[model samples]
Target: MSILSGILITLIFLGIFISPIIGIIAGPKIQWNNQMKDSCEYFDTRISMGTHFPESQYNIRSLDQSVHDQTFFLAPVFAPQADITAKYQYYHRFSGNTANTAHLAIDVDLENAIWRMMELDGPDERTKWAAVGRKRDNAALPAFENVNQTVIYNGTIEQLGPHLWIPDFMMLIQGIDDARQHCEIEPFIRVFDVQGAPIEYYESLIQPKWNWSPEWDEYLMMRTASFGLGRQRLDMCVRENNFRTFEFEEDKYKGVSDISFVPLAIIASYRMRFSEIGRLDCSKDIMDKARDMI
Candidate 1:
C-alpha cells in the first residue's frame, strides 16, 4: 500500500477502538457532573442551620443567653393531645391522675442518616454513587422534602467510652416536635471553646447497627396484627436496618466530668407548637429526670 493508504487504515482502526471506550467513560462523567451541581445548589439554599450563629457564636459570654438558660434546665415534655394517632392515643386518654412523665420518653430516630460515604469521580468531581437510587446508592442523604425542622444543641463533648465521644455537658436544642407519632430526628453538634471558636462539628443520620432480634420482629408483628394491618405490609416497613433505640449509660461518664458548652443543631419534621396545647409545668420530678438525662 502507499504511505497515505497505510496511514488512513491506521486512523480508521484507532477510531473504531478508542471511540467506544471514550464514549463509555465520558457519558457517566458528564451525567455525574450535572448531578453534583444540582446537589450542591439544593443543600445550600434549602437547608437551614436552625440557629443564627453570630461572630461571637462560640464565645461563652457572648452566646445566646436564652438558649443557654434553657439548656439542661428545662425538660422536653410532650403535651397532651387527643388528636394523635391510635397507636399513641391511649397514652393521653389514660393519664388523668398520672404524672405527665410519659412525655420523657426519648424516641430518637437515628437511622435516617443525612450524610453518606461519598466516592467522588476523579476529573469530573462528581459522586460515584448517586443519591437518587434508594438501594443502589448504598448511602442516604437528607433532602428538602425529607427534612422539616432544624434544631441546634449547644453542649460539650465528653468521653462516653473508649471510642465513643458524646455530648455530655449543658445541651441546648430548638425545633423539637412532640406531635409526630413517627418521624426522623437528626441531631448535629457544634462544640465551641471559651474563646468563642468552634472546636468541631458532628452530624449523622444514624441507623441501628445491630441486627434485629427475632423476638423484636415477633413483637412488631403482633402489634400490627392488632391494628388490622396485614402482616406482609408491616413486614415491608419493618426493615431491620431502619430502627435503633438509644439510652445514655449512666455508669459510663459519671464523674470527673470536664464540662464544655457546645451547641447541638437538628432539623426535624415536627414543630414544637405548644401555643394551643399548653406545656406541662416543669415539676421537680420532671426537671430532675431531665437533668439526669443531660
Candidate 2:
C-alpha cells in the first residue's frame, strides 16, 4: 500500500482505541441537578402481560379466544397522542367472576375500593376520592384521566371489579397511609361478612411484574428496554400473607414482603418494604409465547 493509505489506516485504528480512554478519563457523564416530575411516576418493575391487569382474561382485547391468556399486554402510559381506547385498555382488573371471593380479593366492593385520588381540579365534585384542599373543594381545573374504574353490569349482579392505576410508588403509599392512620400502625383489614354481606380479604395488593419482546416481534411498547438492561429482577415490596413466601431466581433475596391487603381502600396503611420481586426471563419474548400457543 502507498504511504498515504497506510497512514490513514493506522490513524483510524488509533482513533478507535483512544476515544474510549479519553472519555473515561474526562468524566463520561455530566452531572445535573435532580428534577422531579410531580405529576407522573416511573415504575421500577414493569408489568408482565402475564400479570393479571384485568381480573379476567376474557375482557382483554384479543382477536383470538383460546389464547386470551397468552396475549402480551401492559398498562400503557397515558399519551395524549395515542388512542386512549386501545392503549389504556391493557392495565385493569375487571372480573366477571360470580364466586364469593371476587377479583382475587384485590377487590371486595367496587365503588369504595379507593377512598380518594390525587388530581388537580378533577371533574365530578361527587368524586369519592378527590383530595379536598390540594386544588380546592371549589376551584375548577381541567380534568385529568385516572386509569382506575369500576363497572357495574347492566342487568346482572355479576360485575367487573375495579383496579385503579396502581402506580408503583411505595413512598407515596406511606404518605397516603399517614393521611388516614395519623402515625398509628394498624392491622390489615380482615374481611368478614358484615350483616350477611360476604367480604373478601386479599393476601397481597401488588406483586412484581415484567415484560420481554424479541427483535422480530416489532410492536409498540413491547420492545425490550431500549438500553438493554438485561435480566433484571423486578424488586418490589408488596402486601402479602403469612402463609406464602415469595421466592426469586436461585433463591436470591427470598421472602421480602409480608404486607396484607386492606379492603375497600386501595392505598391502605400496612405496606412497608421493598423485598419481593418478579424476575425477567430475558431468554425469550412475545415471539416465544405466540409460537407456543399456536
Candidate 3:
C-alpha cells in the first residue's frame, strides 16, 4: 500500500476510536451530572434520620400458635416485616422506648413434643430416642444438637406470625419466664431514592401483612430512622458527586449493637408491570441518579 493510503487508514481508525471519548468529554450536555445534582437535593429533602438495628431480628416467624403442638413445626423462614408506622407509634406511646421501635421479631415455633423430648434426657438422649434404641451408644448420638437432629425434626420458620409461643420446656431450659422475652433484630437499611421517596414506599408494595410483636418495636424505629438519614445522604451525593458525607451521630439501645454511621448509596432495579409503569419509572430514575452520585 502507498504511504498516503496507510496514513489515511490510520487517521480513520484513530478518529473512530477517539470520537466517543471526545463526545463524552465535550458533548453539548450529559444529563448524568445534572441528574446527580438533582438526586442529591432530592435525597436531602427526603431523608429525615439515620439509624441502625441488630442482625438477628430480620427472621420472620409464623403467627399460628396452634402449630407448636405438633411434632413438626410448620412454617417458612422469610424476610422480616418492614412496616414501622403503626408499630412505632404504638411503641412510643406504650413502651416509651422510641429508639428501637421499628424492629421485627425472629419467630421460631417450638414443638411441644420436641421440647419434652429434649427435657427428658437432653439432646443426646433425644437423638438416641429418635434412633429407636438401635443406636444408643452410637458416637453420632452425642453430636446431634437442636430439634432438627431429633426423629421428628421440622424446619425453621422465619416469618411474621400472629401468636408467638415459647414451649414450657424451653422456658425452663433457658431460665426465662417465657420464650417471648427472647427477641432478635435483623440488620437492614432504609433509604430514599434521590427523588425523596422512602424505601418503605417500595417495600410495602411487595411485603405481606402480619402482626407486630412488642419485642420488634426498637428494630422498626431504627430502620425508619435510617431510611430518613439515607434520604439525606443520598441528597448530598447528588449535589456534589465527589463530596463525602456521613451520619452525624447514632444512638444505641438495649439488645442492639454494632451501629454503623457510614454514608452509603444503593442502586436497585425492578421490572414493573405495565400497569405500574408510571410510578416505577419516576422512582427508578430518581434511584438511578442517586446511585450515580454515590
User: Which candidate number has the best lDDT?
Assistant: 3
| lDDT for position 51 in model 1 | 24
TM-score of 2: 0.19
lDDT for position 13 in model 3: 100
Show where candidate 3 strays beyond 4 Å. 1-87, 90-258, 261-294
RMSD to truth, every model: 24.4, 20.5, 21.0
The Cα error of candidate 1 at residue 275, in Å, is: 34
* Residue clash pairs of candidate 2: 53-92, 54-92, 55-94, 116-129, 117-129, 239-259, 240-259
- Between candidates 1 and 2, the lDDT winner: 2
List model 2 lDDT by residue over 10-125, tens digit each.
Answer: 99999999988866664323110011111012211212211111111112221223322211111111124366543222211222211112222122222222322111222222
lDDT to native, each model: 0.22, 0.23, 0.23
Query: Model 3 misses residue 136 by how many Å?
Result: 46
lDDT of 2: 0.23
Best by TM-score: 2
Evaluated at residue 279, the lDDT of candidate 2 is: 15
- State the TM-score for model 3: 0.16
Of the pair 1 and 3, which is ahead by lDDT? 3
The TM-score between candidate 1 and the true structure equals: 0.16
